[model samples]
Target: MPLASQPAGRRERNKQQKLDRITAAARELFAERGVDEVTTQEIADKADIGAGTLFLYAKTKGELLLLVQNSTYADALAQGKSEAASLADLLDAVMAILRPVVECNRKQIDNGRTYLREIIFGDPEEPHHRDAIGMTVQTEKAIAEVLQRDERVSADDAATLAHIVSAIMFVSMAATINIAKPVDEIVAEIKDQVRVLLPK
Candidate 1:
C-alpha cells in the first residue's frame, strides 16, 4: 500500500518539476524579449519539453505569459503589503503598496501591457487566467485593509475605494499613450488619482 502511494507521489513531483521548468523557461524568454517576440516552441525547447507538453501546462502564449507574470505580481504585492504596513500616512502607504506593482509590470514594457490585456481578455476558465484575476482581488483587499485604517472610512467604502484604486493602477499601466512613460511617471500618475480618492 505504501508502494502504491509512492508512485502517485512521484507522479505529482514529476508534474511539479515540469511546471517549474516551463515557468522558468517562459520567464527567461519573456524577460529577454517581450512575450510578443517569444515563441512557445522556444520556451518548450528551453524547458526541454515537447510543444504538446507545453500546451498541457498553458494552452496559449497569453496563458504562458500569465503563468510567468502571476508569480512576479504576487511577489510585488507581498512587498507592497509589507511596505504599506509600516507607513503612517494614507497616501504614502497606498503608494508604497502600488509602487512595486508598477515597477514589476514595467520591467518589460510590452510584456507588461500584454499581460494586462490578457488579464482583461483571457479566458477566465483557464487556471492561469483565474490566478491572475485572483492576484487583482488580493491587491484590492490589501489596499482596502489600508483604507480601513482611517476612522472615517466604513468597510464598504474602503472596499469601494480600493476597487477604484485598482482600476486606476491597471489603467495607468495598460494605457497606450503611457507605453513610453517611465515606471516612476506611471506610479506618480496612479498616486495622483489615488490621493484624490482617499478621504480628506
Candidate 2:
C-alpha cells in the first residue's frame, strides 16, 4: 500500500494527533527542564516528530509554555467554580484554584518563583494582566453578591468590601512569609482578616 493512499481526512486527523503529541511533550519538557532551557527541537524529538513540524504548532518555546500555563489555570478556575459556593466557600475554592496552578507549575513556582510572580505583576503587552483582573473581578462580584444577601453584611459597602477582602486574601497568601506556617494556621489568620472586613 502507498503512504499517500490514506484519505485526506485521516491525514488531517493524524496531523492533529501528532500536534497534540508535540504539545504534550513540550509541556512535560518545560515542566522538567524549566521554560528557559527547553528547545523546540528537543520537544519535537520527544514527540517523535520533525522539528519543522513542531514549528507549525508553536512559533516559539515561549508560546508553548504560555499555552500550558493558560490551560492549567483555566482548568483550575473551572474546577474551583464547580466546587465552591458563596463567599464562605471561597477560602477552599481559592486554595483549589491555586492547587492546579501550583501543581502544573511546580518547577517554576518552587525553583524560579518568577513565573507565578509574572502573573501577579503582569506585562502590559501580555494577556496575563487582563486575565488576572477579570478573574479577580468575577470573584469580587460573587463575594459582593453574597455580602449583599447576607444579614450580617452591610449592603451599602458590599462591592467595596468584597474587593478589599478578596485583595487581602490573595495578597496575604502570595506575600513572602518570614516564617513558614501550616496551611490551616494561615487560613485561620486569613479568616480573621475576613472577619475584620465584615460588619460586627
The best candidate by TM-score is: 1
Candidate 2 pairs with clashing backbones: none
TM-score of every model versus the real structure: 0.95, 0.56
Residues 1-200, model 2: lDDT tens digits: 67799556887899878977976997788778677777788989999988888777666665565545665656655665555553364345444433333344443543223344555665535554455556556656656765665576566588888778666655544556712544455556666777666655
TM-score, cand. 2 = 0.56
Per-residue accuracy of model 1 over 48-146 as CA lDDT, tens digit each: 999999999999999999999999999999999999999999999999999999999999999999999999999999999999999999999999999
lDDT of each: 0.95, 0.60
After superposing candidate 2, which stretches have Cα over 4 Å from the reference? 1-23, 33-66, 86-108, 111-113, 127-129, 151-156, 178-186
Query: Residue 74 of model 1: what lDDT?
Result: 98
Using lDDT as the measure, which candidate wins? 1
